[model samples]
Target: MKQSTDKIAVLIISAIKGGGAERSVLTLGQGFHELGYKVHILRFKSLTEYDLNPNLAYHLLKFKPYKLIPNERFRHKLFARAIDNFIEKKIGKPDIILSNLEPSDRVMVHSKLPNIMYIIRNNISNKFRLTDNNKLENKISKLQNIYRKHPCVCVSKGVENDLQARLGPHITSTTIYNPFDKQLIKQMSNELYSTPHSVLKPNQYIVHVGSFTYQKAHDVLLKAYAQSSKAYPLVLLGKGKMFDETKALAKSLGIDDKVIFLGFNKNPYPYMKHSRGLVLSSRFEGFVRVIPEALTLDTPVISTDCPSGPSEMLPASSLVPVDDIDALAIKMKELMAEPQSFRVSLDESFLPKNIAQQYIDYLTS
Candidate 1:
């Protein structure tokens, strides 16, 4: 068996934060460190605030150190090229390069480096909108051709299937589920996972933990919560630019008081563990890790049976038709009315350490 000391540096690039892919990369980097590997994470731009383990070595490929100054058209291109070239030179020939953030095209430039593997970790599914679907299908098709010359990995089997279906067999891809620290999640849950909104001195409430974006379908979630016959407060956590529209929708539906927007907070485990049950109304997903997260906390879940994940992760009894606010409302009411019977545990077969070993085996093979 090859010890972790034999492992070379695994580099993960981040354009910015506040995305599942970014969060997964950070979590994986921490896992690598825990496994006694020499791990290094490189970011295109310096992070303003990142929650990361202090032991890992993080590199920010910034042109200017003092402040983040956005470069102009040509200058931005040159800056990007410079960063790519700098990564190739200073990284001392990495064993693998994990691309998690946007503009995945940057990997094409670094593909020049010899003896280094490429792992493409994607989190979102390609079924949201027509415009995005068109763009992604095209780009992913091109990436498929590129991967024929050099292979890479995908985040989930759903994403792998979508890639192969769109780009054809020329793309070589395999699914590696996101790795979350089970011990850490347990500890975090134990410390912070209090009854939903215990801080607010309340016990009956519905919780949603995700960015306030359209893909999350907060509008439908709120509409469903409003329509639900159960009389309980709804807590919407996480921050985003779309808050005003979602808030406005709640007011229009005349349930503004019933819905509470808690903005963004790093520690949402407490809110999640304490809530009556989690309500996720995503349009699509590569795989919803939060489904398992909620289950690990023994929190009941009521999710829209979306394309690739929620239904597959949770029991069929917990799922409802996508965009069907009536069904969603009914499901939420069912869980709320029967909290004792609703609580359930997530399957442990796909735990983080096991998933990490799967990736390692595939990469080494």
Candidate 2:
């Protein structure tokens, strides 16, 4: 594959937080850079939690304060205009622009930018239900308009289906799974921890890596773990506003001793590599990156058959219904009793190079 030395691709997102969407943007940016496309990242905020490729150019936009405006729609429009002006001044126009999340996508759509690709990162139906304000009807109307104006890319087929259902079938879109860096994850997993933590004892615990939030359904995970008869402990990795509440839930269930909370480890691959298995109890997902990451490491995985991602990635046997404590417990116990029986095959279609090339082809087309 010959490198495109003259092409430039700009990736726009809210921030470089340690979430699946943010990580996907970073991976795509790195892939484009490796392919000799001059890549740039335009983020809304300056706070970065993940490491970025040094070759990629980074730019931050400072949004104007609109606290006086009570209507979020107006505020968003104002901020979108500000972002348009910022891009014009700082980076000018690129060969292509890949924007992530609703805010960035809305901005790009409103900007009337050519060769813009909007990446939808979650189950839109579930996310709107969780975060939508009183103007629900109006919100959907605006989203439908945005979808009609741009070429959208969803992280999974489930997400794509949900989006078309919500915005009408005429909305132009395609599915592009999130890319994974297998070599990087494997290398990180092999690196010795500077300070070894006792909670990471080999084959002694099942691991769940995600934010402790309502969407992640940590409460359901705790309840399932309590119901299961498995002897291995459960480890929760990552931090969120619901940390204390989730801890209290574990205590209330009388399984605090068996549950360990290791808040936000930057290198969770080492822990994932040594764990008995990885479990995802998300209420919904765009595409569960951890499932593939675990499979790449040969770790077994069990996930809730949520709205968007799990059913697409895992076999029916490895999935249980969302928030179904009894079924989740049964699956957990089954995996624990015969861990080797539930290994998932990693899909090579999501390799970084392949997905990146798809993006290039789409943008150029």
**What C-alpha lDDT do the candidate models reach, one value each?**
0.66, 0.84
Best-fitting candidate, scored by TM-score: 2
On the 0 to 100 scale, the lDDT of residue 190 in model 1 is 58
- C-alpha displacement of 90 in model 2, angstroms? 3.7
TM-score of each: 0.84, 0.92
Candidate 2: where are CA atoms >4 Å away?
Answer: 1-5, 64-82, 85-89, 130-134, 194-199
lDDT of 1 at 202: 32
Report the lDDT tens digits of candidate 2 across residue range 1-365: 22343677889987888887888888888778777778889988787888777878898875435546688667767777776676666666667789899867766666755788889888779747855578777878888888788788898999999999888888988998899888888988997753235655888789999998899999999999999985888888899999999999999999998888888876789889988999889898889889988988999999999988888888998999998999999988987788887798887877777889998787667
Candidate 1 regions off by >4 Å? 1-6, 63-89, 108-110, 114-128, 132-141, 145-149, 191-199, 349-351
Model 1 lDDT, residue 241, Cα: 78
lDDT of 1 by residue, 1-365 (tens): 23343354555565447566666766777666655666777776676344776756778765444225453334445655665576656555555556554354344433454434445544333432454655776666545555565555666666667666666776666777777666666677656433343434434787888888777899888888888864778888878878899999999999887888887766666777777878888877767667777777778887887766675667788888888888888888887787555566666645654665666677678
Error of 2 at 182 (Å): 0.8
